[model samples]
Target: MSVPLTVCISAGEPSGDVYAGMLARELLASEPGARIVGMGGREMADSGAELLIDIRDSSVLGLVEVARSLPAFLRKRRTLRDWIRDNRPHVLVTVDFPDFNLGLAAQARSLGVPVVYLIPPKAWAWRRRRGRIVAQVATRVLCLLPFAAGFYRDAGADVEFIGHPLVDTIDAYGLPDRRGAREALGLSDSGRVVGLLPGSRTRELGCLLPPMLDALDVVRESAPDAAAVVALSGSTSDASVAEVTAMATIRGARVVVGSTYEAIRASDAVIAASGTVTLECAIIGTPMVIAYRLSPLTYAVVRRLVRVEHSGLPNLLAGRRACPEYYQSDVSGRFLGSAVTELLVSDAARDSQSGAFSDMRAKLGPPGAMQRAAAIVAETARSWAHE
Candidate 1:
């Protein structure tokens, strides 16, 4: 029997680490002899990939944060590039982290390594020119969202819609019973529970947490029994956790930093920053109000460049307002509190929203997407090694 080929896969954030880990597991399951190695967080390392670097070091968000971390980022980039050049793997797979991933793809292409981009950058949303750059570097692009396939195809990239991995993950977990979830989170039955998901990035926490805590305080006055919980990203720092805890305590809200799913499942409503978590909430059938704020300069540039009407994934997927989104100047504590309160009090509204979320979930298609992605990567590697 022929030995399995080596595939290098890199993912530079918690979510990317998760998808990469799932993909690695699936690839190994299908081709037991296949070798997987690359940069990822602990989850991916635990799943079997030979860890080149921990993604935590490179997972900063926003222009300012990226700028601040430039030296460290450059050092890691050089190290990975050297590793890839020396190893010369059969295939290089990049999972999101577009800014960094795109450069890595370019390096792999220069080495004549076949590149498969998983969860290609959101060029369709803002930086449309990235499409052409991706087309030039990647042998193939596998997209999670249906619309992404068309965007990349039009931009001259070979693309496939593998459906979202979130669908498969959520399906496997199943929806938690609302009451059971509340009990698990130690939430009271007499009042509403609100989930606060600022985001996983340090910059996002700095921009989002204070306002969210302020909103929770306002919410408490109107509904004295109301409780708030913060979903802490595994990537968060002890300092950030302390900051969130102090703020939550001052507001009389509970803060939980590691288990994101439990917080979402237990909440009567969620106020989240726009990103993957919005889609997760929709798949879990949680009612949510999505909001986001960027650095003034970033927002100013993005506002003009971003072509989409909806910022949240659920809303964009539905091609309608599946959830309310507040951006930049529009995102205020009062507005956020009002949105959460509306969802909490209106059972009929929640039911209708839940039904819409279910429909959206159905559109996401079947489970095992990670396995499918893994199979594709392994097969591609095998074919290349023969050449």
Candidate 2:
């Protein structure tokens, strides 16, 4: 009997945790006997990946926040290294969290373990210099977007576009039926409805949700019958929920946790923060007005570094403003309210955005990306065994 190859995976942030959990699912499907150890949030652990540490509660936004996390990072790094020395896994799979993962990749490489980076750093967007470290450490870069293949390849890494994992995740559940979704969430089955996705991170809710509530007032003025619902993530704080609940009482919007997909399906449109949620909204054919705000320091630093013209992924995928996006100074209740109202009331505008979503969907590669990546990881592990 052959020994199973072990894979150590790490995903530090919320979005990465999602994809890492999906990867863990596929890895288990592909190699049932293989051991998968990871550091991530509930999703990965729920998928049965043994976690060394859970970064679900951890949120760091800017350089200042990153600096504060240095001690914890050092401890995590040391622990993973010690585990690597003793366990000697065949591969270290990193899912985003570039700052932490890149260093760990280097160490894993030094220890003669193959490193595979799933959703490697967006070095093309900023810090192109960091791609050098990814190239130096990782044996393979499994890129989620086709556009990134050339960028990572240019960085001198062995790169493959694994397609967006969302395709499969979205497909597995199938599209949400609006009537059913509305019923499930206890929302009205009729009239104009819009989703409010402040963001998955705490900092985002603090900066963004107030503006969204104010915007909802503007939306209500126009579409008096319009219903609004806020999708909540597991990491959302109780205080944030209390604030949203209070705001909802005054605004007549429902605040729902753990029903993001249903909320997206149940809505006529979504006012979303610029992140993975926008892509999720797009995949479901929902028209969204994307709004974003960062800490003054984080916004200042990010604006200077980000090379992309669009803040929303759908817009980025379209290479143009398929969905209207407001950032920093541009984010306003009046403006966001106007956009949301237009989408809810105007079929032509909503159809145009939905059509753009169809085009964007075609470019997102195919479904089953997690399983495909698992097969690749298994093959990579075998190659390491021979080496």
Candidate 3:
């Protein structure tokens, strides 16, 4: 409603923080004086957003974990709602965290502000009816996944599928040669390098890292010359970092902090936790075995709710076994080590997975997705500001 349109962004996850930061930088490049504010992690603050809350470090991903964090979630919701009511930003941009964000959008709508949903809840994956409900809350939906548009469109929501921000993110790395990257990190340049990304949450590190390291140990026994790197993400706790580094170091793998693309780049094959990191592995054209472990009760509770064929995003987007997924019961050191070894030892196996990576990348949309997304948000937010 004014020349310097105020935009509020809510991004509570590490992946979302990366996107929010990229989007914020793009927005600032175009609208230098505009006020950008909201909830995110260090990356968003680094991009010049006035962080009202930093929930990225504390993001969780399990059925039981969500239940445990409900109190803090509620407080965050109330704070965001009160801020929207009082400050009344021209446009509200929500990045994922659908359970929390849809409510924030509802509050922004109640105050007559335009809402732009970025990487909104994937109702197609489960609870299909919520997609229809989301259609009514946000003014425009910017989808990063290719199939995401049809879901919102079918529900009669305004939606556009900009190319995934990941492409742009990865492109910035310039696709360095694997040996050169490994050498740059001071790792052995000849042997197989396995990158281990055990997710980015406290519970994820707790539940997944031990087993992932166990798998790394199994690999070390067979290919003693092989190298490994346990890559910690932005959300990892100081305790988790210490644990992962110590454990991985004992298994002959060094611990690297938070350079995901470089980690993937340096590795020949990866044993990664199932999540957005799987997509990062795929984007880097690395063969991977994806693993996820949840609390037994949480696994039992949400097992039936999952509607997709593949648990990993790379496999899910491929609509087939683009990469192997070992869930709670299926996850074992043997299976994970064998998968990584298969990719490392066999050219045929690696080639097949590489083919699927190409297919997955095609489905991921084009590069410069953040700039495109920022353009859409800017146009919508500033449309009638001068009227």
Candidate 4:
């Protein structure tokens, strides 16, 4: 009898954890006898990957946060490297978290283990030199975006555009009934609802959310019947919610945690921090304004490196501004409020935006991305064993 194939995986943030979990589930279903081990969070562990390290311990963002956690991160890295060296798994699959995952890929490559990268680094966006490093280390790169495949292919890496996992996950939830959703949340169906998604990261909330709240106050003045609800990330602490909640209540706003989709579906419009949530809004056919602010140093560094003209997924995918964007210095309460108010009043604007969103969703292709990615990994492992 052939020995069961062993695979190791690693992810460094909540988003990565969710994606890793989905991939792990698919792998187990496709290859029932396979053994999976990894450094990830609750989601991946729940999906049956043996957890070696919890992702929370290493999920810091920004230069300052990483600097403060450097010693501990280094220690964790040493432990993970040792585990990889000792176990010699048939394959090491990395999902996002490029900084840590790239180093691990290199180590696995040196040990003659194949490395598969999902959601490969955004080298086209920044640090182009890293593309060469990826080409040297990764045996295969499974990309979510079509452009990402071209970028890696040009860099001499074997890359495939496997369609986006969001297509599979988001559609499964289906669209929420707007009036029913409003009633469930105790919000009046007659009033206009504006969804506020600050972000999942503490640093993002601290820097970007206060300005968003201030902007909502301006929005309320223009549209007196408009009510705002902040969608709290599951990863954010109660203390963080408290700060935003106090501010929101002072301005007559509502706070909803854990169910971001319901909040988004109920909203007449959305004011979201620029990231995956923008993609979610597009998928749900919600019109939105995308806003983001980074630390001064990080913003400056990113300005020089990003090759793309837009940051929001809706904007990037459409190759046009499907929604208003406020970033870095442009992310002021006044600017954001003006944008949101415009979206609230213009039916033509919302219709046009929603149309673009539908088109983008179609471009994302069909569901079952996780299952497809897993099947590829399983086939590769089986082929390696034969050789």
- How many clashes does each candidate structure show, in the order listed? 1, 0, 0, 0
**Residue 92 displacement in candidate 2 (angstroms):** 0.4
Candidate no. 4 TM-score: 0.95
lDDT per residue, candidate 3, 1-387, as tens digits?
Answer: 346768899998887898899889999888868888999998899998899999755888866778888999989988888888899888899999887898889988888888899998878787788798789998899998877888899998999999788887787767668877787678877877888888878777777777777787678777888888888875567887887787777777788886667788999888888878888888888889999888998888767776777778888788889787898866888888888888888899999899999999999987889888888898887763543
Regions more than 4 Å wrong, model 3:
383-387
Residue pairs clashing, model 4: none
Error of 4 at 55 (Å): 2.0
Quick one: how many clashes does candidate 1 have? 1
**What Cα-based lDDT does every candidate model obtain?**
0.83, 0.86, 0.84, 0.83
> Which pairs clash in model 1?
232-257
Q: Any residue pairs clashing in model 3, and if so which?
A: none
What RMSD value applies to candidate 2? 1.6
**Alpha-carbon RMSD of each model:** 1.8, 1.6, 1.7, 1.7
lDDT of 3 at 337: 83
Residue-level lDDT of model 4, residues 61-119, one tens digit each, is 76566667778767766777788899877788988888778888888888878888999
Cand. 2 TM to true fold: 0.96
